[model samples]
Target: MKQKLIVEGHNDILVISHLLMAKNLRITGYNTKERYEKEFVSIGTGKSNNDGGKENALKAFKAALKTEELDRIGLVVDADSETANPAIDTWRSIRNILQQNGYQNLPAEPNPSGTIIAETDKALIGVWIMPNNDSEGYLEHFFEGLINPNDEFLEEARRITEGFVSDERNRFSPTHQQKAKIRTWLAWQDDPESPMGLALRDYPRLGYMSLDTPLVESFYDWLQLCFDTYVE
Candidate 1:
C-alpha cells in the first residue's frame, strides 16, 4: 500500500525523509515535493517555491488526494510562524477541507500527541503542526529541539547565533532565528554545508539526536500510526 506525507518546504521533504530512515522506517523511494515513503508512504512539500509555507499547505493536501494508489496521508506544517501559538487557525482551515471531503470526527484543536482521523468508512488522515501542536513555531524551531543535550557545541553555536541581529549582516527574518542557530551549528560541522537532511543523518557529530528526544519519539510514533506501519 502507498501513503502520502505533505509538508511545507524543500528541506522538509529532505529532513523528514531522512528522519524516517533514521527511525528504521524504510523510505523505498527517493526525495521530492510529491512523495516520500516510510514503509512506502511518500513525502512532498505543500506548495511551489514561490508560495511555500503553512498558508499554502492546503494546496498540497488537495493534490495528495489524487495520488494514483493513495491509501492514507499525513500532513505536517508549522503551527503559525508569525505567532508560534497553538495551530488552531491552521487546523481550522484544514478541518474545513477535511469536512468538505467527508472526513469526519475532525477536532477543534490539534492533539498535542499529533492528530489522527481514522473512521470506519473514510480515508485515514493525520495532521501535525510542528514544534508540537501546542506551541507557536516553524520547522527550524522543530529542528532546534532535535538537538541532543550531549552535543558539546550546541551552546557555543547558540551563543554565536545570538551575536547577530536582523541587520544587514543577518538578513534572516526574526522568526527564523532558530534557522540561523541550527545552520551555524551545521556550518561548524565536518562537512560545513550539511542541509537539514544530512544534519539528521550525521547525528551525534551534528548534535542532532534523532530517536531519544520526546519530540522525536512522538513524531515517529505519529508517522507509524498515520501510515499504518506497525511492529511485530
Candidate 2:
C-alpha cells in the first residue's frame, strides 16, 4: 500500500525532492528521515554516505523483503568507482536477496533502463545505479550531464577546477573532479553558494537547467517506469 525510494544521502534526498517539485510531480516516495512516524524506515540512519550509508542500504533492502504491504521499493545509489565496483557490488548483494525471496529470472547485471525485481505477493524492487546503468560515477555526474550545452558558466567552472592542479592547494581525488566542478559552478551562480538541490529546483523555475536533455529525460522515464502503478 506504500511506495518508497532509498537513496544514499541528504544530497540525493534534496536533489530528488526538488527535481520532482520543479516538474510539478507529486513526491513519489516517503521521506524516511522526516516521516519516521509513518513507519517507513530509511535504508540508513540518515542518508549520509560518509556514515556507512551503503551498508545501511543493504539492511533496508533486506527489511523491505519482509514488508509485504509495500507496493514498490526503490534503491538509488552512486556507483562510486573509487576502489571497488559499488554499483555491481550493490546489485550483486540485492540480487542475492531477491533470488532468496523467490524472485526469479533476475538479470546478471543491472539493466541500463533500470533494474526491476518483482513477484506475486511481494513488493516490486527497483534498483538505479547512478550516474547511469553503465557508468562508474556518482549522482554528481548525472547532474553534470544535465547542464545545458550553452551554459558558459559551467565551461568556465570546469576550466578553473580542472586547472586548479597547478595551484598546489588541490587535495580532492581525481575521481571527484565532477563533484568539484559542479559545486564550483553552483557557487558561481547568481545565487552564490546555492546547493545542488536548490539550484536544480530554482534554476529551472528561472528558465535555466534543461529538462529536455536525453540524460534528464532518461532519468525521469526511469522513475516513471519504476513506480508506474504504485504512484499516481
Candidate 3:
C-alpha cells in the first residue's frame, strides 16, 4: 500500500525526509516528474511556490484524495498564530476541510499529542500543526522547542535575539520571534549562517541540539503510526 505526505514548502519536505532517514526508514520514491512511484510514502510540497498556505494545502489534499495509489495521507502546516496559545481556530478550520472532503467525524479538538489521525472510507488521514498542535506558530517555533534549556548560553541568546529583533533598523515583525530565536542560535553554529533545514540536518556537526528532543520524539512516533504501514 502506498501513502502520501503533504506539506507547505520545500523545507518541510527536507525536514521530514531527514527525520525518517534518522530512523533508518529510507524514502523509496523521490518526487521526480516521471519516476514518482508509490513504493514508499510520497512527500511533496503542496504549492509550487511559497503561496501555498492553508487553503492551497487543503486543495492539495483534496486533489490527493483522487489518487488511486494513496492509501494514507499526512499533512503538516504552520499554525501561523500570534501567540503561544492553543491554535483552536486553526484546528477547527482544518476539521472543516476534512469534513468537506467526506470525513464528518474528526475529533472536536486535536488529540493530547497534537496529532489527528482517523480512518476515512478511502484512506487514513492525519494532521500535525507545526511547532505543536496547540501552538500559534510555525516550524521555527518547533525548532525553538528543541533547544536545550540547560545550555549555558540560552538566556544570553534569548536576550541578544530579543534585542536584535526589537531594534527599529532590523524591522522584523514581533510575530517572528521563533525565527529570530532559531536564527540567533544557528549563528553560534559552526557555519553560523545556515537555513533552518540545513541547521537541523547539521545539528550534530554544528554543536546544536539533536532532533531527538521530547517533542520531536512524539512527532516521529506519530509519523510512524500514520505512514509506517498500510491498513489493508
Candidate 4:
C-alpha cells in the first residue's frame, strides 16, 4: 500500500498547488483560481476578510481524507493578527470537530513525546502549525526560494501588491498590515537610483500580465509535491 500524507497549510498551499500542476502532478483539494481571486479581492478591497475560502478549504480537506487512504495528514493554520495564537486555537477547534465526528489520530504539539489520540482507524501522521505573518519573512522567503533569480514574476507580484497598497482607499481597508507593508515596500523599489542602490528597494505595480508565468509555475510545483505525498 502506498503511504499517504496530507498537508494543511495556509494560502501558500495554493501557490504550491499552481506550481505543481504546471509539472502535471495530480493534486487534490487545491484551487489556484480561488487563491488568486482571494488575494486580488483582498488587495483591491483592502479587507482582511477571507470570506468562505478557509471554510471551503476545510471542506475540501475533509472530502480528500474520506476518499483517500491517508497515511499521514498535517493540519497547517496561520496565527491571526492578535498574537493570542489564533493558529493553535484554530487547530484545537478543528480537533474538537474531528473528535465529535469520531475521527482521531492527532499529534499534540512539541512532537515526538506528544501522544496520539486515535478515534478512528485512519490515523494522521502529524499536525504541524506554522504562523503566517507578513513580517518575520516566511512567506517572502518561501517565494524568493521558489522564484528563479532571473524570473520577473517576483517583481510583478510585488507590483500588483504595491498598486493595491498605494491606493489611499486601501490603506485602511482592513487588510493585514504586513500585506500593506509588502505592497508599500514593492512600490518603493521604483524610486530614482541612489547611493542606497537596489539593496532595499520598495515594491512596484505588477500588472496582471506580469503575474501569469510565475503564478502558474509556482502553483504547479506545490501541487506536485502535495499529490506525491498525499494522494493514495
The predictions' CA RMSDs to the true structure, in order, are 3.8, 3.5, 4.1, 10.9
After superposing candidate 3, which stretches have Cα over 4 Å from the reference?
27-51, 66-69, 83-86, 152-154, 205-207, 229-232
lDDT by residue for model 1 (22-130), tens: 7667533423324443433333434345536665666768766644346677888887645444588778878888877777778888888899998765668888888
- lDDT against true structure, model 4: 0.39
Which model, 2 or 3, shows the larger lDDT?
2
Candidate 2 TM-score over all chains jointly: 0.83
Model 4, 1-232: lDDT tens digits are 2223333333344543443343344424433456334421121111353433344445544654566555444443333335464455556655665665467555333222122334446644233233221222223333444334454645665565556667654544534544444344444444433111121221212321122344333433333332333333
TM-score-best of 1 and 3: 1
Overlapping backbone residue pairs in candidate 2 total 1
Counting clashing residue pairs in each candidate, in order, gives 7, 1, 0, 31
Better of 2 and 3 by TM-score: 2
Local error of candidate 4 at residue 169 (angstroms):
8.1
Q: Candidate 2, residues 1-232: lDDT per residue as tens digits?
A: 4877777666876777666666666544543336522443354554445554666776777677676667888788877575466667667877898888778878888877778877777787888888877778877888887777678888998888788765755688777788888998888788987999888877865655877777777777777666642333
Could you tell me the lDDT of residue 52 within candidate 3? 52
Q: What is the TM-score of each candidate against the true structure?
A: 0.82, 0.83, 0.80, 0.41
After superposition of all CA atoms, the RMSD between model 2 and the true structure is 3.5
User: Which scores better on TM-score, 3 or 4?
Assistant: 3
Name model 1 segments beyond 4 Å from true. Answer: 27-51, 66-69, 150-152, 166-169, 205-210, 230-232
lDDT of 2: 0.73
Selected candidate, larger TM-score, 1 vs 4: 1
